[model samples]
Target: MFPGPTIPNRQPHREPWSRERLMYERAIAMGNAIDSTSRYTYGSALNSYLTFVRIHNFPVDPTEETLSFFTVYTSNFIQPRSVASYLSGVCNQLEPWFPNVRAARRSMIVTRTLEGCLRLKSVPVSRKRPLSLDDLQIVLSHFHHNPSHDDLLFISMLLTGFFALMRLGELTFADNPRLRNWRKVSRRSTVTFNDIQYSFHLPSHKADRATSLAEHAVSPTLIQAMGRWSSEAFKIYVRKHPVLLHALLFGADH
Candidate 1:
């Protein structure tokens, strides 16, 4: 009458994950290693390599000679500096498939081909002139008399960008709504102003370059801190304007 040996209750058994599923997840994680723009650039470079191989009836496997030839071919149309970037893109994208792609890219033949392209096809770099205090004065004079709301806004942005060493994109929203990121946008509440001065919170910025009107007049350390520069790279952006140079030699009062 003891119930003929009681049975133990147990949960149902589950199957272990398949290798394919785990690999697929790992592949997705790997893909996310680079940002969207880099992904696009690397993907384009990979596609270009594939197309070259297909059209030339060459093996899909990358080699020193093939990459060198590719470099020379691309250099014919694009700048040699850009071709170097393309090679970097190719290395990043192809390393997963061809473990030795970087080795091939770094080969003497490939490197020399890129250098030859540079020597043959390089052009002088054209950079837009940096804004100066005189430019700010011009803007100020334009809005001196009875500024409208939009004009005031423009002036505010110009002044902030000039003094804070901020980019225009940091101060305003993109014209295309889709391109706007709320996280990066500064809200009105973040800005505070008084008769003497004004300040605002910057959510994010790509502080690659910066210059200050008070360059030589102030401590380099202070300028670096104000610009939130992480390195001395900011020195490269420090323009040697006549006014700043004069201030360096003479006192600020002079």
Candidate 2:
């Protein structure tokens, strides 16, 4: 018999990634780094869904029926937005394992139920009252009379933050303080003179991530309060702990 025609060796074709694809991948990586809080929130929501399934003896596979029931059941205790957040959390957890399961969230029945719940359970929103100048005076007076180095620092932070529109996080460390490499106000950056103005740079803030070096002039009233606290008080406080000169405008004690 004649030998069959020799077949040519073949290799799998590999397509080069487009610029858009490369950029998309890089964007996802950066997004993952920044969404630590969202990850935690979604994880907590998934845990609640799992607990509900275990207790109710529902099927492991999420169906439209299951999601609809869950929305109604959860609505008794939580607002529609919260139930929606929980549903999103559950969907995120399940999508990897059951790629076709997203239909549960998109179901018309589930959507109608969520809308009905929102109408039934809605309440008027309450907002925080803004602080007035008089309110600020009372706070400053209390700290001024106390006259401890800590109290002086507190006064300085209050006055500067009020005028500058600074967030609490920028002015002070979180509850569990640790040194981070992010930009912060330093003593050398501060200019406390007859002018009574503060100048410091922030690498990032809640509103924006762009680097900002700003100087906010202190009001005459605030300047007098700062005098009572004494510039020497701040200098002495930083002297004992040199790190404060670099880490914060109002650094930690001890």
Candidate 3:
């Protein structure tokens, strides 16, 4: 009477996921997680690797030797740093299938090969020419007389970005017209004006990936420029697109 009827243990039956199905699901999840720009970069890298593989008839599962060869081959055309980036991109693309593929990029052979190529070929590192004061004056001269809304906006942005030392990404939208994450300069972010100097919070930047907001001082020149833009062009812009109150300070067509 003490023990109740014992139930027989039954194993639940389910169809196992196929390798292709698992890969597809993982890809979907990864695509959702990564930014569009990064995905494009990775895809480009993978394409380069695939092209190399096709030309050389290499296996899908790349060996350290194959990777080293690819690096050296690419180094002949591109800079060593670019070759390294391509290798990293290929590694990232393959990591889902081969977890240890990224390690190949870090191997001694790959490192030594890159170093040797760098020493052998004097590939000058391409650098962006820094904007000079003369350049700024030349640019501003165009908008000196009766500047349009667009001109005013451009002038203000140029000045603010230069003086603030903001990254292009921080100041402007993504290079792709389709993928724009416009950051708004809100009223709350701006501090009280004191003797023509005011501060505003930079919500996010490349270097400061964390949530910490950076405050930058607005020079009198920038303030005046902003005021001029806002008075005429900005007012018209706001009237045209009333919904842009909390949108990008420099609005785009979108």
Candidate 4:
């Protein structure tokens, strides 16, 4: 057989990136992994860290001792819980620069210092009270007198949202057009109804209140799926109603 037509040697379409350039690109990719808001928060944390080091004449590197001290010092000004969040942000920002920053942050010294700060500087939690059926009834009474189209619409949304356990974001579009996401919205086309009841396709819903009602009624797996929880982190959101707790403790026979 005739020798295969000799192929001419061709140069690579692209040149291999230098090690330094590759490293820089990788760091950029790491930053892009988190949202812009999260990046801003992390950037603030890093700035705080840099300021701390500069003022104290400490090394820029994040060592266990430095991170621990930073945690304690920062906690004195902000809430200890906020300090913890700040540390998490710091770790995210610094991890690319100092590969072992996470390990340093997680070290026993840093963790214990953070824990001690929390105890030393304890603040009362100021959580907003969740809306109840009584609140719903009050709203209904307000609209009952002279319900305009807008008023009726408000009542309809209120009822549907309460039962569906929808978030405020799901119920309404953002005032800022830039923030409004059509993909997240539930349009009229998604709704269906019969004489008995009406239902709509919710693009997403992760109501903590749903856990209060369904805690005993459903399996943990089902609850997690409904809550769209990737981990057991949903436990933090769980606020067991006293009645539900009592029922769980006792039985249907009781």
Winning model by TM-score: 4
Backbone atom clashes (below 3 Å) for every candidate: 0, 0, 0, 0
Off by over 4 Å in 1: 1-21, 144-153, 168-189, 192-197, 205-209, 219-254
| Greater-TM-score candidate between 3 and 4 | 4
Per-model TM against the reference: 0.70, 0.54, 0.61, 0.70
Off by over 4 Å in 4: 1-28, 147-157, 169-203, 215-221, 239-254
Question: lDDT values of the candidates?
Answer: 0.75, 0.63, 0.66, 0.77
Stretch of 10 with least lDDT, candidate 3: 206-215
lDDT per residue (tens digit) for residues 155-195 in model 4: 98888777787777778876856455677878789789999
Better of 1 and 4 by lDDT: 4
Clashing pairs in 3: none
Which ten contiguous residues of candidate 1 have the minimum total lDDT?
A: 207-216
lDDT per residue (tens digit) for residues 190-239 in model 3: 65568866556766422211001111222323433543443566455444
lDDT of 1 by residue, 1-254 (tens): 55653577575887878999989999999987875557877888888878888898989778999999888988888898998988888899888989999999988999998999999999977766556677789989988999999999888877877776677778777675645568777777988899999888878644422333353366555656767766655554454334444444453443
Write model 2 residue lDDT over 142-235, tens digit each, in one string.
7766589988888787766665545666677534233332345334444444565556555443321101111122232343343343557545
At residue 172, give the lDDT of candidate 4: 86
Q: How close is candidate 1 to the true structure, as a TM-score?
A: 0.70
Model 4 misses residue 108 by how many Å? 1.4
Winner by lDDT: 4
